[model samples]
Target: MNLFSDIRDLVIDTLAAMQGAGELPEDLDFANVTVEPPRDPAHGDMATNAAMVLAKPAAMKPRDIAQVLAARLADDARITSAEVAGPGFLNLRLDAGVWQAILRAVLAEGADFGRSDLGAGKRVNVEYVSANPTGPLHVGHTRGAVFGDALASLLDFAGYDVTREYYINDGGAQVDTLARSVFERYREACGLEPEIADGLYPGDYLVPVGAALKAKYGESLLDKGEEDWLEELRDFATDAMMELIRADLKALGVEMDVFYSEKSLYGTGRIEAAIESLRDKGLIYRGTLEPPKGKMPEDWEPREQTLFRSTEHGDDLDRPIMKSDGGWTYFAPDVAYHFDKISRGFDALIDVFGADHGGYVKRMKAAVSALSDGKVPLDIKLTQLVKLWKNGEPFKMSKRAGNFVTLRDVVDQVGADVTRFHMLTRKNDAPLDFDFDKVTEQSKDNPVFYVQYAHARVCSVLRKAAEAGIDAADATLGDADLARLGHEAEMTVIRKLAEWPRLVDTAGRANEPHRVAFYLYELASEFHSLWNRGNDEPGLRFLQEGDPATSQSKMALARSVAVVISAGLGILGVTPAEEMR
Candidate 1:
């Protein structure tokens, strides 16, 4: 049960009563009314803007409306006191029984306590970590993978039918370069000096692909021309790289539901169909774009090209779909890819891209909007760069990847759980610094460890309770006398626990998984604070001497924190630490 939602409904019902009694206007919009936690906890448990938002509409002063509403709210048994503050806002203090019910709900629901149905099972396709099949995934792609995986999990938890997807960039010239790189390695395996061309991939990771090729073709492809072997090698090299990429993702515990090929859009009439759909909508036409503003007019040549009317759908300007030579531009295939997604009947689409792809956002959105006739909304999230630090210095690049740190490099040093949790410590669009020293250190400063430690502490309490011959299982704790948990310190932690369902819905709606990390940290802080307080006040301890009843009641509260933490960490793709060593 969402306590905030319950209180909001109470406020709404009270307002409707006011209208029925002729104390307020009959027809007033209460859609803007909100019940939320007060900015300052000292003020009250919750606050509402019902009076403030309804003042002008109701033809009444905010304070006048608030005064009457406070009296109406105080009539409810759940609302202990409703006080008017700050001209119009009504702050509410709920009865202690309300928090007790929330704790009972936590034990009853377990991990599903915070699950939301805000999405209503709408199909959402989340495309992320679409790195080119050239090498192992690097640090930038690592951030995208973690962010996207967590986001997909969050959406699923919020009741969205989420499909995690990765688009292969194998149709580009880069794959051709990869073919040549593998050819060199194949030559090296054939007992010849392999030429490490300047523009070709020089990483030794391709050496195994070359050895496999040699094993298959023997000396038959040794003297073959580029035309004869390029196509076969392109497929072979990409498939090999994809296998390695999958392994890299596996190391980080990421698995995509679909692996879309960029090549599938080509030579299959898909691109033509997508463009024709835009043409039928009068959004596609032959046109010459205005030269860029900073360019010299004399040097600018205006050539006719096929363009999409992207500006009509919120882009800054129309975008070209095809080049002057009649070949599809990079944007054309992406449009076709999204068109395929739309054809599949998804309710919404989300693309998680690197910061470098920021320029493509508006146009891609415009394409999906036009293609889906604005029925399906597309949200694009850009993950900024991740700077790796080790031993108080910038982490060096990987020899396997040649130029950047591979995802495996980071995952190998720190396990997948730590890597995933730490990566989400910042928003997708914010730059993140992954410090090995700080993240691995077992201290309160480390958020991952801190949160995990709270879960472990709960487990420790349960273990000690069991050793003392007290039944601390969920079934037993859930039935414990929760009314005994009336201390202010205990209520504080329960209040934080009560926010989980609201937090899940908010994070899911905003498509911001970082909020989950932030919430987990705050919840951990509240739990740890209560745990520390137990040292000075023996009465606050979860286990009491010669008082089994009180001990079970307090232990129930501690178990509720673990339940929420486990649920939160599950959304982040991090395993809850049963024991932190």
Candidate 2:
């Protein structure tokens, strides 16, 4: 069904035939040969570098080989012409019937047209949005959440066994701070004036956690010391905050398959086991780290510490696993967590982190490399900051979240579909500007609206064709006289559709889901252009006047565009618009 792949295979088969006819050497490697769209459409439909790549290796002139290859390819029914241009590049022009067959393939396959098996069912663990379970998720976490969730979906479509995961940062001192903040709210709920001290979480979201704690423990636990209440309240508050986090994710249509707790690694011998595994490999040692570059800290001094030889595994320097006070450092638990992931036998790992954690990327990768002995690959994607705009100025923060904008605030204002689509307009490594006024604007300038409008227009076409008593169902239209779709505008759309499978494979291989968003925009642009062209050219319209036979063929092409859009939007976790409001 992938016309590009089909054509590429034809080119490779023809090269093999040329080798058999003694036109090229038998030892020439064909791995470098590639068939893709020509850089300038005016040149041809597709281009191949088989002649150019094999010329020097086969000890023959590129044009001489291209001439022979061109003659062999011209014998095939799919290729109309293969012309040698500029040294050795072979540009190919496919027959019009090839595009007709592609349209029929789209009608037959529907949403599953572009699905690929690129990963071959390899297990991949994608961990993202592992924000601290202290309060509601803010805008930074929102980008990571959307990026990670969409990546998981994209990989799933590309045939990877994806496990959507969230690593809870609940084992650190941040949770203790959360417990103290909830204690203040608990006092307020008990009719006592609470102390909203500095360094405590002041968000009103904790008000309910306090109320729930009061209902469960009553006045009995209020008089206890920190030792008695800290552990109990930390567990209670983290659970409540996680519940709030879950609801926030649900609003944005994100659901994790695994919520791995960092606390589970503590007091479970898992940390020791992970460290011991590295120790057995001679990667653990006790040493004093060199002073950091540039200005030294005020208390700079060398001290003996337990360190991991992270430099051996690609880190910039060895990292301390234990502080001078003999307690585990902040990175110890992270090492244990990744070691556990390796023990589970995943073939690959991907972590989606906020831009602030860019420095942690190398060390984390080193840990996984040492733990897995370089058997698995770890890909860390950092989602950059999002700047929200509205009313000609930066958007205001959520009062409920205290200082930052909550995920729910964005979703509630612009809706989940718009929020999700707009968030992915930029790549994960690039900064994004989310303009509230612009995203909701129903114009071509707005990508989300333009793409959704295209889907809605296709639905309108289906409805109109059905009302006209023309059978436009996939099965009926799939068998229509697709040869009537010979117009350049119609063929342009089919050309874009043909790139779907190739696009899926490329995006999956690079771990970039933003490419899907970009492709959808281009496909929508082409579809809208053809729809507009139909106004003046009567033969270009999807529904022909009083001719169901002609109308069905064109309607089939329009419906195929909708099918691909739905499939692309599905990967992005955005529901396709049935009708535009």
Candidate 3:
């Protein structure tokens, strides 16, 4: 059960009673009224802005409103005390039994404890890791994959019909470049010294692709020019690179529900169809954009072009769909792609882009807004750079041009679990420092280890209780007399457990899955503190030598912690550790 929501409902009900009694005016809007944790723990468990929100609307003083609302809230058995602090804010303290019920609910729910229905089964398409199909996924793509995968899982847990998607950039010039790079390696495989061109890919990862090309064509296309072989190798190399990319993603515990081809939007009347949809609304027109501000690029010109009135839909500038030439611009296909998503009947769309794509956010959002006629919402999240560190220095890898680190390199070094967990330690837009030494270190400094150790500690408690012949199964613990869990230290951990549902709601609404990692770390810290407290106070220990009832009560708390941690880790696509070495 969501304790905060339940308590908020109680507060709302009391306010309605006040209105019925003529103590407050009728028809007051409580949409903005919020009940959340107090800024300071010294205030109380939760603070509501009900009085403050109602005061101005009801034409009454905030303190006068708060005094009566506080008294009305105190009448509920669950609320132990309701105190008005500051001008009008009401702080509430809940009964100890409330926390006990939350623990029981957690044990009963198991892996579904923190699941929410906030999304209400709305269709959400999350497109991420849409990297160019040129080579293996590197560190930058790794961050997007982890963040997007975790976010899709979070939305799924929060009751969204989440579709994990990858848009393959096979229609771009980068894939053409990929074909030429592999052709050079093809020459090297055909017993000729290859010319490693200045703009060609130099990574050794393509060595196998070259060998496969020879095995397929076997020197038949060796002497052919670029015109004949370019198109053939473009398709062939794309398939090979996609296979490598798929394997790399699999190694990191990520699987997309769909792999959409960008080329599908071209030559299929889809681009014209999307533009015509906008044209019907007068959003598409022929106009010349102002010369780009600041330093003009070599290609800048003043010519009539087909542009979309993106500024009308909140974009900074109206964007071009087609240049002065007859050919469509790069953005034309993007507009068509999002139109395809809208046509698929998704209620919402999310694009997980690398930080460099920040410039495209506004134009893309404008496109979706115009194409969907402001019906469908688009949320774009950009994952920032990941800086690798090792041996107290910046770690560099030459796995690709620009000295990029491969996803396989990171995953192989510390396993998929550690790699996924550590990558999300920071938010998607915040630059992250991936220190090899820090993430694998078996200490509290390592959040992954700390959180995993907490789960392992609960397992150890279960084993110890089993050896002592105490029936500590979840069925028994869930039915135990949880009233024995009254100590302040024990209650603190339970209070944190009660925040899980609210956490899921807030984090899911914000579309920020990093908050899950943050919450798990905080919950793990509180649990570890309670475990240490048991050392000095025998009554707080999970195992009571002579009292099976009290031991069951305490062990129930430990198991409840494991339940929440397992659920949280599952959202992050990291396996919960039964035992950590």
Which candidate ranks first by lDDT, i.e. highest? 1
Better structure of 1 and 3 per lDDT: 1
How well does model 1 score by local distance difference test? 0.94
Q: TM-score winner among the candidates?
A: 1
- Across 483-577, the per-residue lDDT of candidate 2 in tens digits comes to 88988898889888888988998899999999999999999999999999999898999999898999999988999999999999999999999
Q: Tell me the alpha-carbon RMSD of every candidate.
A: 1.0, 1.5, 1.4
lDDT of 3 by residue, 173-201 (tens): 88889999999989889988878788788
In angstroms, the error of model 2 at 279 is 1.3
Worst 10 residues of 1 by lDDT: 397-406
TM-score of model number 1: 0.99
- How much lDDT does each candidate structure score? 0.94, 0.93, 0.92
Tell me each candidate's TM-score: 0.99, 0.97, 0.98
Q: Which stretches of model 2 miss by more than 4 angstroms?
A: 56-61, 297-299
lDDT of 3: 0.92
Q: Which candidate model has the greater TM-score, 1 or 3?
A: 1
Query: Which parts of model 3 are misplaced by more than 4 Å?
Result: 296-300, 400-402
